[model samples]
Target: MEDNIKDSKQLISEIQSQYTRLSKGQKLIAQYILNNYDKVAFMTACKLGETVGVSESTVVRFANTLGYSGYPKLQSALQELIKNKLTTVQRVEMSDDFSDENVILNKVLRSDMDNIRDTLDGIDNEAFQDAVSKILKAKKIHILGVRTSFVVAQYLGFYLGIILDNVHVVRMDMGDAFEQIVRVGEDDVVIAFSFPRYSKKAYQLVKYAKEKGASIISITDSLFAPIASVADNTLLVNNSMASFVDSLVPAMSVANALAVSVGMKEKDDIKDYFDDLERMWEKYGVYE
Candidate 1:
């Protein structure tokens, strides 16, 4: 929770740190954001400008003054600040424009496409390659995810387990999840998945693993995410916020890419392993 608050405050701090240098109109914009960020997070540039009694161009310039490419980017930062705080009911209310049945499907699909594109544009390739290398060399691999992120962790674990004999998907069903990875050491790696609303337990697990000397690879939506601070390698992915239920397509794509990359690297070994398994499965009529 402390890290989560820090993450939210980072943008506010940036705005405050830069407030003195801003023009009067920009200051008006900033003041409104400082006072009513939750409202401004959903407002368009034109609407924000109108509320601040400035021209729409002023809002755009204000965002640029704050180092964002445009108002949308600034708005995105504001949304990130409050995303974890928003309730399911709040999200549904905020996304009320989706009520139009004719455009909802296309709107959702297009939003997902944009999410993947943005993620591709922003992902750090060097970090990604480093994660792959570390995974292949680790003596043990522990993967953790809960809530929405659990779906992706499971997908990654299922494939990685088949390719490598060292994969362990941390189970949160009964006992303490921390107890499962208590012996994590320098030779091991911990891959954690977290997104907004970020999971507190996931961050704690990753933090604990880091303290225990394990290499950490984190997949999350922001560099400010709690787990990112503990990660040896961090992968960023964009998730669609068009509706109450955030789309996991971009995160899922990154997980798929990791699995495929690892599989490709161990193709020769996996080939024989799969062939033997296929023979056994056929003998037992496992596939029907």
Candidate 2:
């Protein structure tokens, strides 16, 4: 009944506090839900029963034991917990009522907006400023991502190139990524973007960059992600709401902020670079 016992960890602790009171099947259900809260948020009572190796009726009873009126109510609470913790895309997928397209669309949009708001609230300004500083100091900055994240990497690279010097957006085939990573050195930095169903190539790039003494700044889904293991600095993004789509609005916002911070740090350098480019354009009629 503690107000603090709202999340999965607290929920698990609550179960533990009452562990001695639970029946055999209810105990199994509790253990399964505690261990797999994320999975349980998206599963039905029958499916959860199968997962916990308990009868469907036992699943309902387990929910009742947890103070829910029924399984559906329990599921709703679990879903809400996940909604609070996961990304928009992740929350949509886990949600039970996906039959209506309009409902799903509304939920997705709302969730995405919530994600952006939450990210802004949780972002460490000092850490972000440090990342900007590292990027500004690097001789070369490589932006690397594969698959769906490639689009984000490319966009960041394009915008950064306009405002900073020596920004390389590397999104060729994975085979080429290895060659490119090898060219990076201690004086460089690699800003990597990857999410769930994360790319092995991205992981390799992180490893390769680390081995070559380049600083790695990663934007990924969670602290548990493989990319986090090697990152000198990490920005955690939530993308867990929906199904397969990786909603990138929040990631894009973060990238733009970083770019703006870097530009502001090197305002004079950026202005001079743009001035030189404009002169070259005018002299060569490049725009025409």
Candidate 3:
């Protein structure tokens, strides 16, 4: 089947072109969507109808009228539209509306759990095994992420470096970040973390790495995320929000899974490495 129409411009054009043909109820829904698409993206079909003074089926029909399979498909398209387009202020505003009016802590905690659940549920096992395989086989593995994502990259890279050899992290602070991966080639693997409001430079680095024949593994919020489009393996992680900041719990979980999986794949090598590290730690009295 053809994919859902995801481009906001195209979605808007479809709605506008079909406006006159829409029944009164759908027109009402259309008008609301046109006026508040970003906000509407977070809403369920039932809630959207409640806001537009229509029935849930009416909202579903409006989505079908726009050539979407159903309301969820249409809403997903809407989300794709604003994922990177919204600024921090716009995100805060939209998140405020989606979250509960009371019990702030519960809402935030629940949202993080939901994100982790959804991320786990939607994972592609094939892609995951392939990611582990690539990491294990790569002559060198380069990790790249920037801004908020840098922390995740560091966490993964630090642990992976402990269990694996020839691991590199690209960080702007470390003079000439790109130079770290300049030698990447067909035998290399580039695992990048990118979320909403993605880092443009990270995309450039990964693109360059891909062009150099390195395999790309992208852990991001959506498959259409910039790096994912060029990635050899795409791990879709959920980073939903109930507050101003986007949740990173799910993303971190994915990174942890990858590190552990890779370590398991190279069990003997990692065990030896850890045993040596333990000796060094004991000798240096690194622990209390």
Candidate 4:
């Protein structure tokens, strides 16, 4: 229990580090817990085992592998950690009555604002600046995101392309992101966004980009996220402001900051890029 509260990342890393020592059943339980932490936090041993395709005794053994006295104790620690880290409104909305429209609106707004504040406090300035520098200096920038995160990535790619040359946003259903990432090199960078219930494809893209020598910047809910672990630099974003859904306000702000920082860093280059864009717009009659 003490170990679980120390650091979520360290807890998972320790388990992963010793994964080879775990029995087959324990490995199944470990994988389930790691992937469904939020769910396990609220589930009983029976329910957890049912989901993991293991028996209740196997689930208890898995907890013991983590040095817990029993499964209940492990669940308690997970509940406490999640309760402390997740925004209050997230829990409240899950069980509270939202019959009143005004009440719901106020709650959502307040929760989102709190999430933004928490995210700002959690951000590491040096790491953030380093990521920005990587993107700014790269010969090409690739942004990958899926599901809801796709919207944020698209917005970032659009603004970045306006301010920087060689910016590409990978759209959903686009064939083989890994194949696309093969085009990136040591002179390029990849910025990836993924949150809880992370996109496996996004993770693969990050891995492929890294293997190809492209620097990576990840924006995720915690350092425990797969993408965060692989990134050259990571920015933590708090998205648990709502129950079972992640808020995008904080991520959008982070994206905006990255774009503005890169723009300021290459002010002269951006000026020339926009000048060329203006000439093209005039020739194509894009706008009056």
Winning model by lDDT: 1
lDDT per residue (tens digit) for residues 1-288 in model 3:
234434454887878888999999999998999999989988889999999899999998888777777887787778778778888888777765545557787777898998899888889889999999999899999998888898999999999998887898888798877778888999999999999888888889999999999999999988778899899989999886555687889989999999999888789997888898899999999999
lDDT of each: 0.88, 0.78, 0.86, 0.80
Backbone clashes in model 4, listed as residue pairs: none
Best-matching candidate per TM-score: 3
The TM-scores, one per candidate, come to 0.86, 0.70, 0.86, 0.67
Task: Report the C-alpha lDDT of model 1 over 1-288, residue by residue, as the tens digit.
Answer: 122324345788888999999999999998999999977888889988998899999999988877777778788778888887888888887876688999999989998999999899989999999999999999999998998888889889999999999999998885989889999999999999998888899988998899989999999988888999989989998884888988889989999999999999999999999999999999999997
Worst 10 residues of 4 by lDDT: 1-10
Worst 10 residues of 2 by lDDT: 1-10
TM-score of 1: 0.86
List where candidate 1 sits over 4 angstroms from the true fold: 1-32, 46-55, 65-67
Q: Which ranking of candidates, highest lDDT first?
A: 1, 3, 4, 2
Against the hidden true structure, what lDDT does model 1 obtain?
0.88
Q: Judged by TM-score relative to the true structure, which candidate is superior, 1 or 2?
A: 1
Candidate 2 lDDT over 93-196, as tens digits, reads 65555667878888778768877886787676776877888998999999988888888899899989988769988867645777776789999999999876
List model 4 lDDT by residue over 1-288, tens digit each: 354334443566766776889989888877887787766776779988887788999988887877788886677556545653555455554433345776877867786998799789878999998998888788999998888899999999999988876899987777866667778898999999987567788888898889889999999877777798789999988775445456898999999999899889889988888898899999999997
lDDT of the structure predicted as candidate 4: 0.80
